[model samples]
Every structure is written in C-alpha cells, then in structure tokens.
Target: MDSGETKISLKDAENEEKEQFKLLHKYEAEVPKTFEEAISETGFGRFNYTLLVVILFPCATQMVETVGMTYIVPVAECDLHLTIEDKGLLNGVTFAGMISSGLFWGYLCDALGRKKIIVYGYLVTGFFSVMAAMSTSKGMLMGAKFMSGLIMHLSKSKAVLIPIIIFFLFVEFHAWNVFMLICASMTIISGILYMFLPESPKYLMSMGRNRAALVVMRKVYSKNTGKPQEDFPVKKLVNEAKQNFTSSRVEMATALKSGWEEMKTILHRPHINNMILASFNAFSIVMSLNTLKFWLPGIFQSISDYQNNHNGTSSSMCVMLGEMSKPKNITSSQECSVVKFHAWNVFMLICASMTIISGILYMFLPESPKYLMSMGRNRAALVVMRKVYSKNTGNPQEDFPVKKLVNEAKQNFTSSRVEMATALKSGWEEMKTILHRPHINNMILASFNAFSVVMRQVFSSLLVILTFISATCMFCIYFARSSLAVTILSAAGTAVGSVPENLLLTITLELFPTTLRTIALSIHLTAQRFGTTLGNAIFPYLVQMGCLPPFLFIGIFASATGLLSMLYANTENKPLI
Candidate 1:
C-alpha cells in the first residue's frame, strides 16, 4: 500500500454505511498518529511542557473573567441597583451569544485552522473582561460580559479556556474567597501569551500539510530538548496515506457537507434514541448544577443572617461596597469580611472541588477514535491510539494494522514462530474493518460524535430553568437561618451533579473520529460554549428572582429537572480507546 499505489474499494455494501453485524466488537489495538509519533520518534526528548504551558495559558484569562463576575455579587447588587431578576437576566443574556457561535468556531477550526482562532478568542475575551469590569451601567456591563465570552470563545476550551471557565461556572458563586483582581490580571496575561502558540501538529498533518506539521513538531520537541527524530513511522504513514486516498484538496464546502452528512446519519440511526437520552440527562445536570453556580451568592447572602449575627447593624452589600471603593487590601485581610457571603462561598467551594475530581476521571476514559477514523482522518486516529496504547505498553506500535508491522513481526520470529502470528494479525485487521463498517450508509462513529454535541444543546435550554430554581431554593434556606442545611444540601446535590457533567468529556469521546481528533475537540468545545452562553448569561437573573421572597418555584424546577435527567442514557460504562 505505497502512497503511490494504494487501492480503495467503495462497493455499495461498504460505502453505504450499513451494519451487517449484531454488535460493534473490538479488542485491544494501537497505532501512531501525527502528535504521538512526532513526540515518540523524538525518542530522547523530554516532554514539551513548554507547549503545554502555552496550551494552558488561556485558563488564566477564563478564571479572571469568571472570578470577576461571581465574586463581585455583593458589589454588583448595589452599584447597579440590580433586582434579583435583573441579576438572572445579566448572567443568562451575557452568555446568549455562545449558543449561536459555538458551531461556527468549531467548524472554522476544522476548516481554516486552530491556533489563529484560539488566539483571537483569548484576546477578545480579555478585552471584554476589562470592559465588563469597568462598566458603570448594568446594561453596559451585561453587554461587555456577553461580548467578552463571544470574543473569548475564539479559542474555546481545547486548551486553556476549559479549566478556567469550568472553575467559574462551578465555583464562583459558592467559594470561600478568591482574589478577583489577581484572577482578572492573569486573564489579561494569558490573552497576550496565546498570540504566540503554534497550531496543533496533528491538525496540520491531517490536512495533508505535512511540512507544517513537521515544522510545529520540530519546534515543540526542540523546545523540550535538542534531538533528531528516529525510528519514525514514515513507512506506516506513507502506506496509510495510500490506503485512505480521498482528495487532499477537497474544498472546505465539500468537507463541511461531508461533516453534516455524517452528523445527520447518526441522529437518524436506530441508536439515535441514545443521543436523545444523553442530551436530556446532560441538560438536567447542567441545569441543576448551574442552580448552584449562578445563584450561590444569593443563596449564601440569605443564609449568612449577617444582620442577625451583628444585630442587623450593617448590610453585607454596603460593607462590600466600602471595601471595593477603597481598593485597600482586598485579598487577605479584614477588608474581605464585609463581602463574606459565607453560605455562597461554601457552596462554591464544594462544587469547585467536585469539578476537579471529575476532570481527573477523564484519565480512565479514552477519547473515542472511532469517530475520527470514520471521518477519513486515519493519521490523527493512529496518533490517538498510540497515546491509549502507551499507557498500556512500553512498545505500542507492534500491533499496528499496517502490513509492514505484520511482516516485520513475522521476520523477527524466523518463521519458526507458529503460523498463528499471521492468523492473529489477519484476524485483528478483519475485526478493525468490521468495527469500521458503514451504518445506514454513513460513518456511525462520526454521526455519534456530531449528535453528542447537538444533544447537549437541546437539553441545555430545558435545564437552564432547572438550574435557576435549585439555587433559588438554596437562597430560601439561607433566609430561613438554616445556613448549615443549605450548605449541606447544595454540596450533596453538586457532588451528584458533577458526575453527569463528566459526560461532556465522555460524549466527546463517543463521536469524535480518530483522524480529526483535534478538530472534533474544537467543535465539541464550541458546543460547550453554546451551553455556557445561554445558561451562564440568563442564569444570574433566574436565580436572583428566585432569591426574592417566595422562591419555592425555583426548587420545584430543580427537582423536576433532576428526575428528567434520570431518563438519559448511562454513558458511564462506555468503552473508550
């Protein structure tokens, strides 16, 4: 299967995407895609931690924006004369832009590139933060905040934005204390830094721009340590390129069409019900969790009974305002006491910790490579497989599906090796093809990947109300002078909700194709932006209103949504690799 002489068969049975088997069966397998091979081929090298730093820099900005918004609740309540409903509207409306733009950014990342958009997203988000922070009017502030997310979504979460945004969404409304100024400052720094990182190497290679991929890889490795790459999988790739010979120069329009076709095919399949279930379940969790995220401040405010504690002498809002006006030692001192909304801070801390634990869970779950390979991006698939395998073996490329691997393994055995070696290799290759079999005439994995995001979006709208109500109830508990009750209940609910959010990552693994892992990642992130925009923006207003007298309606919403969440598919047991 030399690149020059590779053959392809697209018989109606194969290209039609029909499932001839009763189940999708897979055994352990491995290969090397661009990034892993680039790293591995440079065998003597240390990991490129520098690039990781670059990749993670945007998080600083995200955290800043989040902290700035969530921590400033008391201050915001006073300065803008914000009603509870106004607060909810501010949170929800600000995020409104995200829903419309997420898919576009993801598609752009796939078509045009990654680094440029990411840089653009970071800088834009930073500029908006500054605008939002300095605003004098609620409308202006909301506009600025919404614009910030819209701008920041330029990079999405494929890199730095992921952790930062997640932190704020899950933590800001509930934490004990955080330095908003420092967080804001960090975001500005990251926006400036993102302008410098190179594109993901795997992205370039899949586009048939090997020279660009090679350049980025060399720089990444060189930054780690000076070394020449060796034991490369050059022959393997050359053969793969031959086998997967779709036109390298396919127009962006056509590629987009193919991507859409792949997306629709999944939604229409028999298992499509799973996609619906996944969406609703995810939505339910998001709605309920955001209940805590968007309104924890109000909930904490009610429960603090600070007035009763100090004989109702001074409002915490006024106290916070005094601290903000003076710019006097806000980080570690008596100054923060005025703004200490104890109940809110405690809930935020609980949720934040839960979010951290969930991220760690992703290690046990491999990103789904089936989606990528199904999308005709085999090179990227191999790269992902290598990562999955390396975790399992010191030598991961031995069982690669290429013929060269089989022949080499045979020769090394001196043919004295039982013919079982060839039989084993042949059986493995056959299974690989079967798992890849077309379904309803479309790439099943790719369909699953696309639907995963769409499902998320669908349920997000429904759950937005759910989150609003839950937080509102917690606020009522706070008002009842039952701070402990509110704290314990909110914490328990958040811990449970956190596991469902992990579905975000899990769903990404379900549908993303191996060849376009980075690209698909970018798209899924955009889908996340969709959730953040609509939910986070409107979130503040919803909870704030519920915080007002008689917020029982909010509690009903959360309870109802939680029950609904139980209806979605349990992707917890999904197999990844």
Candidate 2:
C-alpha cells in the first residue's frame, strides 16, 4: 500500500508540472503582436525605461559620428585645401580603415561580448574625434581617422551607424535630424556601459543556462515595457534545460568559439549550401548598397537640376552671394571653417531624417525565428511569430507549446536511434538540396563575369563621352543662369551626389541572423568604405585630368552593385529581425 501511494504521489507531481507549463505557455505574447499592437505594446511609452534607453541612446551616438564623418567631406575641401578630387580620396581612405578592421573587431566582440565592444567604441571614437580636430596636417588627420576605424564596435556599432551614414547626405543640411541621431547614439552607448546592460539572452539560453537566461531577461525587459512574458519563459525554460544534452551543445569561453561550432552546424549538405547562398546574398547586398549609396545623392540632385533647368529657373548658391563676399574677403581660416560647419550641419540633417524612416521599418521586421528555435525558445519564437505573422498567415492551427516539442525531442527520440539519426542527417541533406536547387548560383556568377567584361569595354570609351557631357553642361549652365541659380544648383548637385540608397540595410537584415547581421554588415560596409576612400582619393586627379566628371566613378560602383544583387534570392518582404 505504501509503494502504491508513493507511485501515485510521483504521478501527481508530474501532472502538476505539466499543468504549470501549459499555463506559462498560454500567455504566449503580451507585447505588440501586430502593426497596431506596436504603438501600444512596444517600448513606445517612456514606461519601458530600459528598452527606450538602450535602443535610442546607442543610435544617437552612432549618428553623431556618421554626421561628423560625412560632413568631413564638405569641410575637407576647405580646411585641408582639398580640391573636389581630394575630398573623395580622404573619404575613401577613412572608409578603407573601417573596412579593414571590421572583421577583426567583429570577431573580438563575439569572443568578448557586446557590452565591452560597445563601450570601447565610445571611448575610442570619442577620443579620436578630439584627435581628428587637433590634427595639423592632412597626414595627421588620416592617421587619426584610421585609429578611429581600429576601435569600432563592429556589430553593435553598425546597427546605429549604418542608418546615420545612409542619411548623412540628406541630413548634411538638417540640424534637427543630426541632433536627434547624435543624442540617441550617445544615450545608448553611455547608458549601457554605465549600468543595467544585460548580455544577449538568446546566447545565454543556447548554452543550456535557462535560469541565467531568465534572470537576464527579467533584468533586461522591464515590466513597464508592456512586452509579453512569453518572450521570457520561466517554467518552459527550466524544462528546456533538460533536453539539449549532447556533445554538440557544450559551452565555450567565447561566443566566437561558439560561432565556430555554429559554423560546423552551418556547413554540410544543408547549411553549407545556405552559407553559400548567404554569401552570395551578402556579396550582392553589400556591393549594391555601397555603390548606390555613393551615387544616390548625385542622382537625386541631378534630377532636381533637370527639373529646375526645364522650368528655366536659376539654382547656383555660390553666384548669389553678396558682391562684397569674394574669396579674398573670406581668406581667414576661421571663416572657411565656419562655412564648412554650416554646410555639413545642413547636409547631415537631411540624411538623418531618411535614416530615422529606415529605423521605423526595422522595428516592423520580426526577429529571426530560426535563431530562437535553435536555442530551444519555441514558445518565445511562437509569440514573436504571432506578433509578426499571426494576423495574416502561417498561424499554426493552435499554439504548439515548447513543452510538446521538448518532450518529443527528449523522450520519443531518446528511445529511437533512428529518429536521432534523422535529425543529424537532415543538416547535411539540406545543404545538398540547396546546391541542386536549379544550380542558379553558378549561372549568376557566370553572367556577372560576362557583364563585367562588357562594362569595362564600354567604360573606357564612356569616360570621354562623360567629359563632353560635363563640359557642355557646365558651359551652358554657368553662362545661361544667374549667380544665384549657380549656387542653388551646386547645393542641389551635392544633395544628389551623396545620399545612400535603400538597398544597404534592407538586404542586411533580410540575409543575416541577429547574431551574424552586424558582422555581415561590417564586412559589406568595410568594402564600401574602402571603395569610397579610393573614389575620394582618385576622383580629384580624374577631375584635374579635364573631364571634371567626378560622378562617373559613383555610377560605375552603383552599376556593379546592381548587377551583383541579381545573384541572390530577393529578400524584398522577407522577414528580418
């Protein structure tokens, strides 16, 4: 009778445990689950103190640096006595420094953690900002800028910086946008470094420390934020801790080391193919964004110019200056600096507004579901999915709790070796399937090569044609319009020549995991920054050579980017968190 009673008691406890899990799962998601829900449920109000502080502050600091760097273009021409050609070279060199250090910093951050990486970026960048200001020579400035590149927090920095850079041209003239970004980036970096910053919750959970993940999540997500508890499961988490036991899930000292493990999992029949697919996507996205960003401002300004000319209106701002305001009158160094300061300020603001719009788009994009699922956060993934997808489509017949999945992976699979083998086999099988999927990768690569050949041939002759176009236009416009129109047009042209297009961030979020996103962006942007440096460096020489058509390089880079974009699968409406 005692044995019977003991068995009954044990069974009762198990049932109770199951019931608790069910309750926890029932409240799947409380935060903004849909577009309408975002305003009400997101960190919309100041109540979610932590969320607002973290997200907004980092963004602000990043923008300031971007605005400062981009504004350097206008300033460089005057402060360093740079010709229009020299301006391009300086920008390109600074960007090249950024590209060179990106992967290195990314690896370090992944190895160490986000907190240290971000704080370091602040300290280093802030210090360099002062250094850049103090430099007496162009060489000195270049060295200081390179040092700034060395210290960037690859992943954390990019999320904030990318938007700012993209909008640098638009906001170059807008003070408000520049102010907002600078404030936001500063707030994020400072707040997180000083206090209350928790490490990535998903990273913690992946290593089987469910309790640790819970504690961090609670600390990170304040009650005031109105975020769903489903995003952070206590009992469900405790349950998941039991299931992921294997040689594969062991903890390591650094997340970078973990990345190596992930790479192993990533490669093989399925993941390898996906990695290749991702690589191609990355190649296209990065190249495209870089090229287009370099040329966007020019295109936009050109359009404005065309419209003005068609309407027979004058546009150059320089020619409209007061008769007393001659180069001789503005000979003082301070005067030139003042002009540059004002010019950059206005340009950064326009770009800042556009960047802010992009940020809003990011908020709408959902986080990576595969990442959560891999980490055994099915319940949370489900909640995020509901928020992102439930209203329209792919809503499961009903909420399939994490407990059900966990039990199957642990109990049903443990007794069945065949099932375990199936899971192991699936990883590699997926890779093979991808490569064979119409073999599109090879075809695209070939096409790009062919395209490059044709382009090079045309570009050789096109240079002369471009020079003719610029000379004719400059002749007609300079003489045909009033001085005021000339100044208006120059301002207009600068605007067109600098704005980064939409493809950069859009492709990044779509192609990479939350974990890998920043690194991927760093690599791509690094390439872009280097390309910019080259353009900046070589452009002045090209201009001096007589064509004065500085925009051709920008156009070439953009075309290359577009062509590469065709190699990857379109991420246009695809989910990117």
lDDT of 1 by residue, 1-577 (tens): 5543433444545644444332222111122354565556543323454445644656555555653565465545654556655655565554465654555665566666677666666666655564454444678777776676565444443464454444434432212133432344456456555555677766666666666676566545543443322223332222222223242533557657766866675466543564455454445445546545666555556435454457655443333222222222234333334443343564564467456545534533545667555544455556567655644774544454442211112233345344676689799778656754556337776788787667656654444444444445444543433446556666655654454366444554564445434444544444444444445445444343433422343345345545555454444435553
Clashes of 1: 46
Candidate 1, residue 403: lDDT = 24
- On TM-score, the candidate that comes out on top is 1
For all predicted structures, in order, the TM-scores are 0.53, 0.46
Error (Å) of candidate 1 at residue 431 is: 40
Off-target runs (Cα >4 Å) in candidate 2 are 1-50, 76-86, 152-194, 207-211, 220-222, 225-523, 560-577
Best by lDDT: 1
Model 1, stretches more than 4 Å misplaced? 1-36, 43-47, 152-184, 228-252, 303-485, 504-577
Q: How much does candidate 1 score in TM-score? A: 0.53
lDDT of 2 by residue, 1-577 (tens): 9999999999999999999988766655322122222222222233344456456655666555543454554434344554444444445554666766765664554445555666666655755554455444567666666766666443554454454445444422323223333433453345334334565545555445555556555433334343543443333342232233332343334445655665565455533554554444334323323332342332233334444545745434222211111122346456553333354654554367457645744643566867666655576566666555434653432443333334112233343665676788897568656754655678988898887567445543343343233223322333323544445543443333222223334444456667655555554555445555555456445444432233344344444443444454444434565
